[model samples]
Target chain A: MKKNRIFNTITLLSASVIVFIVLAALLFTGIIDEYNGQLLTLAGIYIIVSLSLNLITGFTGQLSLGQAGFMSIGAYSSAIAMMNFHLPLVVSIIIGGLVTAVFGLLIGFPTLRLRGDYLAITTLGFGEIIRVIMVNLETYTGGAAGLKGIPSFSDTGDFLKDSIIKFSWVYVFVIITIVIVNNLINSSPGRAIVSIREDEIAANSMGINVSYYKIFSFTMSAFLAGIGGALYAVYFGYLNPVMFWFLTSVNFVVIVVLGGMGSITGTILAGVGFTYIQEWLRFFKDFRLVIFGLALIIVMLFWPRGLMGTNEFSIVKFVRKYIRKEHEGGSSKPSKIKGVK
Target chain B: MSVMEAKSISIVFGGLKAVTNFDLKLGKGELVGLIGPNGAGKTTVFNMLTGVYSPTSGDIVLNTSREGHNYKSIIKLKPYQITQSGVARTFQNIRLFKDLSVLDNVRIAFHFNVKYNALQGILRTTAFYNEEDEITEKARDLLKIFNLQDKEKELAKNLPYGEQRKLEITRALATNPKVLLLDEPAAGMNPQETHDLMNLISFIRNKFDLTILLIEHDMSLVMGICERIVVLDYGQTIAVGTPEQISKDPKVIKAYLGEGV
Candidate 1:
C-alpha cells in the first residue's frame, strides 16, 4: 500500500511536469500563432463543458441537453458583472458559476423527476427557452444584437496586457476544473451517484437518497458549465443568443458521446480533437456540417462505447506495475495489465 | 419490544386485493420466517415493511433505535428513508448493482455512514480522506465475514449465483439494520449452498444482534433456522407459531402439501 501511494505521487508529478513543459514551450517559442492559441483556449473551455456534462449524463445516467442554457447564464452574468459592476475577471467568473447553479437548482427540481428521453426533451426545451429569453431581454442582454466588449483576462490590468489573449488563464482554469471533477468522481457521494445509475431500486434500498443526488449532480454540472461560459465570454469578448442556440447544446452532447461518457480523460481528449477537426473541416464550406454528421454516425457505429467506455486510464497503476517488474529482475514478458479486473 | 411490527397493512391495485390485513411482530435477536405458495404476497409483505409500497390503510412501526431515535411509524417514509430508519431488505430477485465492483456494492450501503460532504469531497480535505479510508477498510472487513474478500474487485454480475446471494446479504448487513429482511435468499441454491446459507444466517443473527425476517420456499431451511414461522396463503396469515406447531397445523399443511399431507 505504501509503495502504491509513492508510485501514485510519482505518476502525478511526472504528468504535471509534462503539461507544464508543453505549455511553457508554447509560451516561450512562438510556435503557436494567435488563431491556434484561440483554438487551444476554446478546447480548454470545452474540456470544462464536457467533463461537467459527463458528471450528469454519463456518470449519473441522466441525459441532459440544457447545458447551453447554463453556459449562457454564466456568460451573460459574467459579462454583465464586468460591463455593469466592473468586478474583477475572477470574481465575475465565480459569480457566473453561482448564478447558473441557482438556475440549475430551479430547473432540475421540476424536470429531474422525468427519466430518459422525456428528461432529454424537457432540458432541450429549457435550453431554447433560455435562448429566447436572452434574445428578447434587449435592455439587459443587449437584445437580439447581443452583448459586446466583454473584457478579457489580459484586460484586467495584468502583467501581460500587450498579449492579445492569455492562454495561461484558460490553462489554469482547465487544470482546476479537472482536479475538482476528478476528486468528486472518486469520493463517497460519487459512489452513491454512480450506484443510482447502475440500479435505482438497489441504490434506494441501500439508503441512498436518489432524488437528492440527482439534483446535486445536475446542479454541479450546471455550475461548471457556467464557468465554461464565463471563459467563453472572456475569450471572444462578445456574447449572443445565436451563439448559444439549441444546436450548441447538441454539439456538447456529441462531444461527450464521441469521447466516451464517464471517462474524464476521454472527454478531454475528444473535446480537443473535435475542436481541431471542426476547424480543419472549414475547407468544406457548405458541406462542413454534412461531413461532421457523417463522422459522428461512423464513430458511433464503429465505437459504440466511445473512446474509453466506462473504464479509466490510470497512470499510477501503470507506473507501479512497471516499477515492480523491474525490481523483480525484469524478464521479456509484459507487466500485468492494470485499472481493469 | 418487537424490532418491527406491521398491523393490518393492506394494499390494493385497482380493486384487486394484492395483500390484505397483514400483521407481523419481530422480536429483537429473533429469526422469523414467512412462507407461502407462489403469488401468496410474501414479497409484498416485505415490500410494505421496507416502505416500497405504502400500505393503503394500515400502519407499520419500527421499535428499534437504529436511527439513533426510538419507536417511530415508517409507513409515510420513502424507501430509502425506511432503510435509514433501521429496516433493510434484500429483493425477491437479486438486485445487485450489476456493473459496480463487488466491494462497491457493499461500500455504497455505507454511504449514509460516511462523515464527509460534497464540498469536503471536492476539496479533498483530511476529513474526507480519513472517512473514505475508514469506510473502505470497513467494507473489506464486512466482505471478509461473507468470505467474499477474494472477489472484492470482481463486478457484481460476474460472481457465481451462490456468491451473489451472499453478497446481497452482505450488502444488506452493511446498512447496519435493526431488522434484516431476506426475500427468497436460498432460492435457486443447491442443497449444499442452502445449508451453508442457513448457518450463515444464524451466525449473523447472533453476531450482529439482528432481528431477521426471511421469506423462503425451502421448508427445511426455514424450519431449521427460524424459531417461529408465519404461514401465508392468498395474502392472509393462515397460522403463526413455532416451527413444530406450524408444520403440524392443518391450514399450513393444506397450504403447502394439499389436504392429505
Candidate 2:
C-alpha cells in the first residue's frame, strides 16, 4: 500500500512536469501557428465543458441538455462583471461559475424529478429559455447584437506579447478542472452519484440520499460549464445569445457521448480531437457538417461504448505495471489482471 | 426490550389497501420470519418497516441505540434516513451496484459512517486517506466473513447467482444495522445453497448481534431458522406465533399451505 501511494505521487508529479514542459515549449518555440493555438485554447475550454457534462449525464446518469444555457449564463455574467464592475479576470470568472451554479440548482429542482426523455426535453426547453432571455434582455445582455469588448487575458501581463502565451492561462484552467473533476468522481460522493445511475432504489436502500446527490451532480456540472463559459468569453472577447443556442448544447452532449460517457481521459482526448477535426474540415465549407454527422454516426456504430467505455487511464497503474514492473520483478510479459474499466 | 415495533400501520395505494393495520414487535437479537404465499404483502411490510413506504396511519418506532432513551419514530423519515437510524434491508431482486466491484458494493453502504467529507476527498487530505483505508479494511473484513475476499475485485454483475445474493446481504450488513431485513434471501437458490444460506444467516445474526426479520416462501428454511413466525395473507396477518404454533393454525393452513398441508 505504501509503495502504491508513492507510485501515485510519482506518476502525478511526472505527468505535471511533462504537461508543463510541453506547454512551455509551445510558447517558447512558437511552433504552433495562431490558428492552431486558437483551436488548442478552444479544445481546452471544450474539455472543461465536456468533463462537466460527463458529471451529470455520464457519471450521475442524468440526461441534461441545458449545459449550453449554464455556459451562456457564465459567459454573460463574467463579461458583465469585468466590463461594468471592473473585477479582476479571475474573480469575475469565479462569479460567473457561482451564478450559473445557482441557475443549475433552480432548473435542477423541478426537472430532476423527471427521468430519461422527459428530463431531456425539459432541459432542452430550459436551454432555449436561457437563450431567449439573453436575447430579450437588451439592456443587460445587449439583446440580439451580443456583448462585445470583453477583456482578454492579453490585456493583463506579458501574455499579450505572444499569441501562444495566452494559451498558458487556459491550459492551467484545464488542468485545474481536470484535477477537480477527477478527484470528485473518484471519491465517496462520486460513488454515490454512480450508484444513483446504476439503481436509484438500491442507492436509497444503502443510505444514499438520491435527490441530494442528483442536485449536487447537476449543480457541479453547471458550475464547471460556467467556468468553461467564462474562459470562452475571455478567449473569444465576445458573446452572443445565438452562440449558446440549442445546437451548442447538443454539441457538448455529442462530445461527452463520443468520448466514453464516464471516462475523463476519453472526454479530454475526444474534446481536443473533435475541435481539431472541425478546424481541419473547414475546407469542405457547406458540406463540412454533413461529413461530420456521417463520421459521428459511423464512429457511434463502430464503437458504441465511445472511445474509452467506462475505463480510466491511470498513469500510476501504468507506471507500476509497465515502467517499473514492480510486481513481476521486471518480467517481459504483461500482467493478466486488467486495470480499472 | 423490543428493538423495533410497528403499531397499527396501514397503507392504501389509491383505492387498494396494500397493507392494513399491520403490527409487529421485534425483540433485540431475535430472528423472526414473515412468511406468506404469493401476493401476501410480505415485501410491503418489509418496505414499510424500512421506510420505503410510509405508513398512512400508524407509527413505527426503533430503539436500536445503546442509550437508554425513548424509542424514536421512523415512519416520517426517508429510506436512507431510516437506514442511518440503524435499520438495513436487502432486496428480493438482489439490487447490487452491478458495475461496481464487490468491495465497493459493500463499502458504499458504509458511506454514512465514513468520517471524510467532499472537501477532504477532493483535496486527498490525511483524514480522507485514513478514513478510506479504514473503510477498505472494514469492507475486506466483511467480505472475508462471507468468504468473498478472493472475489473482492470482481464486478457484482459478474458474480454467480448465489454469490450475488451473498453480496447483497454483505452490503446490508456493512451498514451495521440493528435490525436487518432479509427479503426472500433464499430465492432462486438450490437446496444445498439454501441450507448454506440458512446457516450463514444464523451465523451473521449471532455474530453481528442483529435483530433479523426474514421474508421467505420456503417453509422448511423458515421453520428451521426462525424462532417465531408471522403469517400474512392478502395484506392481513393470518397468524403470529412460534413455528410449531403457526404451522398448526387453521387460518395459516387455509390461506397459505392449502387444505392438504
Candidate 3:
C-alpha cells in the first residue's frame, strides 16, 4: 500500500511538473507568433472534436460520422450569442454545448436504436442536413457569406505586454479535456462504453441499458464537439457555411482511425500531428487530402488498431521494464510484435 | 407469497404461436427448472418475465414489495427497470463484454446504483471519489465471490468458456436481483463442467439468497438442482410438479418419448 501510494504521488507530481514545464515553454517560445499561436489554439479545438468522435466511434463501437454537425451547432449557437446578444464568451460556450447536447439527444432518440450500418447512414444524413441548413438559413446565419467578427478571446498578446497568450486557455481546456476523458475511460462508466463497443448484445444481457447508454454516449460526444466548436469560433474569429461540410466530418473520423480509435491520448496526439502535418503540406495543399485518405487506408490495413492501439504508453511500464532489465542484464526493448502491448 | 406470477401468457408470431397459454408461479426462495426440447419457448418465457416481449394476452405480476421503499411491478417494465424491480437474467449464448475486464463487466452492471453525476465524475470530487472507491471495492468483492479476483484485470473474452459462463452469472447477480433467471445454463458445457455448474448455481442461490428460475436441456442437472420442474413443449406447460412426479407424468413422458407414454 505504501509503495502504491508513493507510485501514485510520483505519477501525479511528474504529470504536474510536465504540465508546468510545457506552459512555461509556451510562455517563453518567442518564435511562435500570434498567427502560429492561433493555429495551436485551433489544434486544441480540433483535439476536443476528435476526442468526442472517439467516444462514439472508438469507445461505443458506433460508427458516427456526424461530429462536424454537432460542432457546427455549437459554433453557430455560441458564435451567434456572442455576436448578436453580446453574451460572455464562457456563457456562450456553455449555451453552445447545451444546445448541441439537446440536438444530439433529439437525433439519438429514434435513430441510435437502429443497428450498425443503419445508424452510420442515419448520422451521415444528419451531418448533411446540418450543412444544408447552415447554407440555406441566410437570415439568421448569414448563409454562405458566413458570420464574422467573432470575439478574439483566444488570441495571444505580445509577449512584452506581460499578458499570457489567451492561447493558453485553449491549451488548458484541451489538456484538461484529455485528462478527464482518460480518467473517464478508466472509470466504470467508461468501461461500460467499451463493453458496448466490444459487443452490444453482451452488454445488454449484463444489465447495461444498451439503448440508453448508446444515446447517452452520443449526447456526451456531441456535447464535447460543441465545446470544441465554440472554442474554434473564439480562436478563429470567423466562420463560414463551408466549414461544416460533410467531408470535414469524414476527416475527423479519419483522424480518429489513424490515431487509434479508443485511445484518448492517442487522439490528442494525432489531432496535433495531423493538423500540423496538413498545415505544413500547404504548398501541395491540393494533394493534402489525398495523403490524408492514404494515411487512413494504410493505418487500417497495416495497423488495424492504429498507431498506439488502445493502450497508453506510460512511464510506469517503462520503469517496470527497466527494473526487469537491470535484473536480467538485457536491453529493455521488447519485440515489435510484443511491443504492441 | 409468489414473487413472480405469470397467467395465460401467449405470444403469436405471424401464423405460429411462439408461446401459448404458459402459466408459471415462482415463490420466494424457490429454485424452479424449466426444460423443453429445441424451440420450446423456454427463452420466450424468460423474455416475457424480463419485459423483453410483452405477452399478446395474459398478465405477468412480479411483486417487488420486499421492503416497500418504492416498489414497482415487473410486468410491462423496461428491461433495466425489470432489473431494478429485482429480476435479472442471463442469455443462453454466454453474452459478455469481450474487450472490458471481467471486473469491469460486473462493475458497469452496478452503474444503476451509482449516485454520481457527470460533473462529479469530471471533477473527480469527494462524492465522486467516494462513490468510485466504493464501486471498486464492491466490484472486487463480487469478483472474489465468483473466484475471479485474480483475473479481475483480464478481459472478459480472454477467460475460458466455462469461466465466461460464470462471469455472465456474476454480472447478472451484481444487479442484486431478488429473482435470477438462468437460460440454458448448461448449454455448452461438458459433463463435468455441467456438474460443477450445477453446484455453482445452487451455491450462488444460497449465498446470494436468490430465487432462481432456470431453463436447461440437461434434465439431470436441472433435476438435481431444482426442487420443482416445469416441463414445456410447443410453448404449453405439459407438466408442473416435483422432479419425481415430473419424471412419471404421462403427458411429460409423451412430450419427451413421443407416444411411448
Candidate number with greatest DockQ = 1
Error of model 1, residue A245, in angstroms: 1.2
lDDT of 2 by residue, A69-140 (tens): 999999999999999999999999999999999998888787547999999999999999999999999998
Clashing pairs in 2: none
The list of candidate 2 runs beyond 4 A from truth reads A1-3, A27-30, A155-161, A327-341, B67-69, B257-261
Best-fitting candidate, scored by lDDT = 2
* Model 3 alpha-carbon miss at residue B109, Å: 1.9
Q: Scoring each candidate complex against the real one, what DockQ results?
A: 0.55, 0.54, 0.31
- Candidate numbers sorted by DockQ from highest down: 1, 2, 3
Query: Residue A89 deviation, candidate 3, in Å?
Result: 2.9
Interface RMSD, Å, model 1: 3.4
How far off is residue B203 in model 3, in Å?
1.5
lDDT score for residue B12 of model 1: 94
Colliding residue pairs in candidate 3: none
Error of 2 at A242 (Å): 0.7
